[model samples]
Target: MNDQAARLRRMIEDKHPRSDNKSNNIQENSKPEKLSANRGPRTIAITSGKGGVGKTNLTVNLAIALGNMGKRVIIIDADMGMANVDILLGTTSRINLMSLLESDVALEDVLLRGPYGVSYISGGSGMEHAMELTSTERDILFRKLAGCEEWADIILIDTGAGIGGNVLDFISAADEVLLITTPEPTALTDAYAVMKGYSSISDNPNLKLIVNRVIDEPEIREVVGTLSRTAERFLKISVECLGYIYDDQMMIKSVRQQVPVMAGYPESISSRCILSIAKGLLNGHQEKVKLGWRGFLKRIFRS
Candidate 1:
């Protein structure tokens, strides 16, 4: 843990210097010069301070939203110990991400394609396994994940809540983190705990705040403003407001129907809100350099 932290923290803090055209991490003369695709796919981990704040729901629907915009998306349900994603997606997969560690199945075999060509990979029990992979196993896993750039433009990890090492490893290493929370006092306090856990190791995390189930725009402003101010005051990290989801009954209806609200009812308020957030993320308007999939994976399993 200490070694990976020191290596990754140095990498993170030195990103700007490394982005220069003259300096390169590559030594192979046979390889082509860098292209935009070489920057790799964007990896965003969506998590919250506590459960029941609609984090997984937001993850599935948000993936659909990005897919609708012609972006290839992958949602990895990394919220350990629960299959909420499969239950929500109305999918029951015999092969999961854990299968990769336990067997020789290909990465494509592990993927469950959701709406609009968006793929899903249940973290299954493999999240715990992932955090403790052998060196060879880790190499195989990263090789497969690195291929994601060929097909995917965005990868969203529906991470577990709390300050567990598993959750912290993902959110801390991600290109950006979407910290989901509610206006409730308990939820807000829990949200801060997660942020503190992330800030502990990351040199400077690119975090965005999303307030779910907001009743009104005024409430949105208050919730985001308060959280952002608190983070800046104590953690000394800025949290950007990435928009909010409304308290819509349609979300519940879609869940019961086993379809994402974005796909089931495009006109719903919740769908519109998610689409807006997706657009903000897709347009590259966010003020942060994405750490990419390779970078995210490199920060894992070195403890």
Candidate 2:
């Protein structure tokens, strides 16, 4: 193995050292079988085909909306090199996932609490190292992440834009993938490309689209219809419209102030749109697929 891989393996083995034979036998005998579906936290990856489409904004506000509804939510800023979740929330972390992986710091030590009772883990620049993690290392990392399942009902991953390998790995591993786009032709084209790319690689990928910056209901329907029809026809995949956010000045103001629109302007049109989407998800308006964290890890290592 190369230097990076060797370092990663050492980190994993050190974090979870093997037990003696007698202790291992006793532990194996006492451990219970894995629980059935619908047990662990739900994981949703918010991504886009291209950048500057308000994907992170939606992730932050949507997570707060869910938290307001009494759901325990954690947002993992998985954008890697271009992380801005901390900037959007107006907070700073002395450590991030990279610090945890490369050193002995515990994962909980790196978790930062954001506004509205939502917890988040900043990916920082360590995401580049994630792409190089061997299968064994990834499994160990996922097992470490599984600990977060105890404290959250929902884990929302804010993935980087575009179809890079890191982005694809996170999307494919998520229980649900929320693809955000604008009304622009380029955004729509890239959104379709993301759906097509994911469809080709994953079996029955749970995909949903959120149209941002819509001017009116007519425009929303038109945009959703066009994309939905194209995806159904060309990709042979079904893309559901989770919801849309209207273009609003309050949203821009909130961003400038480093507060989520949901918290700063709950009565704003954009806030209402995000709340409606959160309610839709909670009410089971969307299809139910419970992969949980273990399944997510399996998919990640397999990829």
Candidate 3:
């Protein structure tokens, strides 16, 4: 291995030692992080029933916007099969979460930093094993992630489109879930299906809704109302109105520039809406870091 790889490997071995053998290593690494009251972060999963509903976009910008408002934020690209948050943010991550699970790497090693001072975990590929984490590993992962709650104010997980075990597992583990959808009929229908499924579960997630790429206020209310009414009448669950993002080409442009809308085009309506969403989630907000040379180094060299 190269110098950097060797150095990283040394760090891994120091912090989290390798198991007795390859099989044992797989079992040990697959185990989840342990939970402590002092865990470092609060995790929230952002999901959508269908693709092209702007769920990933909302996740990226909301994470950045939250960071701008002074909250320590980390985005977990939990969309296993088709992870692309790094691509959308224009970050070429050298490592990924899956690598950490498969090899002996610190979670920090796989994280990517983004605009507005946000940290993101790239959802890399080639880990079919991740689908079936051991019960011990699952517990260990959660415990370690929960430890993050001790440090981070918000941990946003961007789940893949559709309602599978992988996506559902992320949702179930989160403190809250933000479901995004567009005004299109198909999107609405699929979103409702997802909500219905959640409501049917005996242990459902704390669900919230956001309508993206909206045309106007009426569309926002209408879409939110549809999901709300269905939840009330059918699922018997309450869904909060997180807010909406208007149709703006600037969003696509900002993505092209590898910058969040909040920074790339701050004054845009979409950016304003995202800020409003962060405010609505006010109870979850925390104090921002005092950015300086010390803070910068601390974040870069988190121990």
Give the poorly placed runs of model 1, Cα more than 4 Å off: 1-36, 284-289
TM-score of structure candidate 1: 0.84
Candidate models: Cα lDDT each: 0.77, 0.78, 0.66
lDDT of 1 by residue, 14-50 (tens): 4643333231212233121222343467899999998
Could you tell me every candidate's TM-score relative to the true structure? 0.84, 0.83, 0.75
Candidate 3 lDDT for residue 196: 76
Candidate 3 ranges beyond 4 A from true positions: 1-40, 102-104, 125-128, 134-147, 202-204, 283-303
**lDDT by residue for model 2 (120-162), tens:** 8887765546657776666556656665665577889898888
lDDT of 3 by residue, 1-303 (tens): 233554565567558754443322113433323322222355577889998788778888888787777777777776765556776777666666556554445544455555456677666542224446655554444333332432366678788777864565556545667899999999988898888766665264478898999998888888998889988898888887878999999998988887878878989999999989988877644443323221211221231
Error of 3 at 194 (Å): 0.8
Instruction: Pick the TM-score winner.
Output: 1
lDDT of model 1 at position 84: 76
Candidate 2: list runs displaced more than 4 Å: 1-38, 134-139, 285-289, 301-303
